[model samples]
Target: MRGFISLLLLTLGLCLQATGMAADKSVIAVIVTNDNPNKSISLGELKLIYWRKKTYWANGQRIHPINLPPDHPLRLQFSNSILGSTPSAQNDYWNGLYFHGISPPHVLYSDEAAIRYVQETAGSIAYADACKLDNRVKPLLWLLPNGETTTNPSFVNCN
Candidate 1:
């Protein structure tokens, strides 16, 4: 309760000591399971993961890619920023992949669920808002729609 209250006050920028704490620090990022040995994540690799082009981790563990629910803003951002199109535009591709037994990434309902899943599962990765990030999961990379990429970001909450 105390933690939630503090977050609420900080979100409103109304706490006496929360004056400069900005949500601007938040971003869309790729999060991978802790056991992953990859030192850096790239946009190209993320695209391959979503396209089901990349299937295994370095240690031969199957990589489980996760998709965000359609209603989530990060879903659209991910679609455009990473997939280069909206979900509808890629419907045919998804269908073709399905026909060939190449399924799309599994969908998780929320950022929290994605984070928890990644934390508990090996070789799993998902895209989510960095604000919800913490020590429980490691963010592989942070990408802006403008083509900027951040590796191992220092999120305010994680600090």
Candidate 2:
């Protein structure tokens, strides 16, 4: 009976621990095409690119910013991390832009979709879990929660 009770308590504790861990967001790397000439971008510049303010890269290529569906948790985390805003903030911004007949970035359904889109499209950028990175996309910046950065030696050539 004592062993059964101990096992039950241990299982409950692990379940609670997993729940808390799920709430903690991790670092995301902004990925672009592997052959993109622009090696790096500042956080402010990246934010503007997403906002559609910085519409083109240095090579005169239109920058296509890709995003996951607004309801996705990682999408919320990306919006909060990069823009200091929520998904509703984006909806409001886009609604305001629509008055002028302007549109927003392409919304992909998953990180894999974003990766595929960026690879096929020139001057595209998107954020994804660092662990999901592949050779097709070159990470330009590694962003942590609360606006911090780390240079990813293997992923980004931003030295």
Candidate 3:
């Protein structure tokens, strides 16, 4: 009876572990892409690019950043992670910028549209959930729940 109880407990533990792994696997990093050959982007640089603080790639090409709808989870994640600001704050910031004739980043309605825009446009950056990522675009940074970056060295090239 003791051995049977131990086995059952171990099985339950394994099941929980598997479920946790699956949950982690569901999250993914989506990125912006450019024709330039650079392989990696620093977190600071990425933030500047997304926030319209920086408008050119490392190679001096024009930068076009795409965005998700205001309410999308990944949009909120990107804003919080990269801009260190909330959506309402960002909206206010953009409004302020716009009043000065400074246009904000272009917003898209969905992740698929954002991906397509990035793929077709040169020096474009966008974000999406990892599970939905395709081979067409590369991920630049991963945003953790704590608003810290998890840099992926493999995707620096914008390939």
Candidate of highest TM-score? 2
Q: Mind giving the per-residue lDDT tens digits that candidate 2 earns over 1-159?
A: 999999999999999997787587666888899888977788889889988889999899889999888877678888887888988877889998888877888899988898888899888999887777789899888877555776654533322
Which one is best on lDDT? 2
Lowest-sum lDDT 10-residue window in model 3: 21-30
Per-residue accuracy of model 3 over 22-88 as CA lDDT, tens digit each: 4442233646664546566787787787768899876788988887877666676677667778677
lDDT of each: 0.79, 0.83, 0.71
TM-score of 1: 0.77
- Which residue pairs in candidate 1 have backbone atoms (N, alpha carbon, C) closer than 3 angstroms, thus clashing? none
Residue-level lDDT of model 1, residues 11-90, one tens digit each, is 77665444344323347878887767887787888889899999987689999999987656678767877888987787
Compared to the true structure, candidate 2 yields what TM-score?
0.80
How close is every model to the real structure, measured as TM-score?
0.77, 0.80, 0.72
* Local lDDT at 11 for model 1: 71
Better of 1 and 2 by TM-score: 2
lDDT of 2: 0.83
> Candidate 1 lDDT (Cα, whole model)?
0.79
